[model samples]
Target: MGAGFSRRAFLQAALPASSALAFFSTSFRRDSLISAATSTKPQKVIVVGAGLAGLIAAFELMQSGHDVTLLEARMRPGGRIHTMRDQFSDGLYAEAGAYDFTDAYVLLCQRCFLPSR
Candidate 1:
């Protein structure tokens, strides 16, 4: 925790950086989807929520040449995932909501977030 570090500012900065990383990640192959396709017609899809699952689904659908519309109830995309700052002693912060990833989801998360070695 730094002197002028606020959750809002941190999120504002992190969002773009993370987005850029995702966009540039080697795992995000736009041509892979096209290459594996069976030459079917593109479909329109509507995805509810902007949480991790919804976002990933939408992105995958879009990459597969489908039209996707993502809807979120909150002002931000991360459903219950958020950070709380200045709520504890000595600049300690807390992460609220779905912060833990179980073993079942480990592979999916790694595939989505990590680069191949």
Candidate 2:
């Protein structure tokens, strides 16, 4: 353990970023809802894949005055953010693959990381 490497210190650093994510999420949702109510000029835009990146981009484009359509192949959005709600009797759920986000991961998400492209 080096400087500022304890669990408490790690959480102290992470809490603010988590709070920022929550705040940004709520603000974006509110803005999108308000845009739908106020906007008139609609533009056609097709976004394939309903992953986090895709969804965020669509929301931003819509807020920037563009009509957006999302197409997901897995019968639902969330790409790797898959949840299994039927696996337990107590209504507990499990997520696959998506876990433990760090600052670098958030930066990649913000940059719309697509390695193939």
Candidates' TM-scores? 0.50, 0.44
Q: What are the root-mean-square deviations of the candidates from the true structure over C-alphas?
A: 14.9, 14.0
Per-residue lDDT over 1-117 for candidate 2, one digit per residue giving the tens place of the 0 to 100 score: 477599788889989997998678655554465476457566788987777767766766776778789899898888888887787778788878676554334644566664422
lDDT of 1 by residue, 1-117 (tens): 488998899989989997997568546554554465426778888998897767766766786788889999888887788777777888788888885664324544666787323
Candidate 1 versus truth, CA RMSD in Å, comes to 14.9
Q: How many backbone clashes does candidate 1 have?
A: 0
Which residues of candidate 2, in runs, are more than 4 Å off?
1-43, 85-92, 100-117
How big is the positional error of residue 89 in model 2, measured in Å on the Cα after superposition?
Answer: 6.3
* Clash pairs (backbone) in predicted model 1: none
Counting clashing residue pairs in each candidate, in order, gives: 0, 0
Candidate topping lDDT: 1
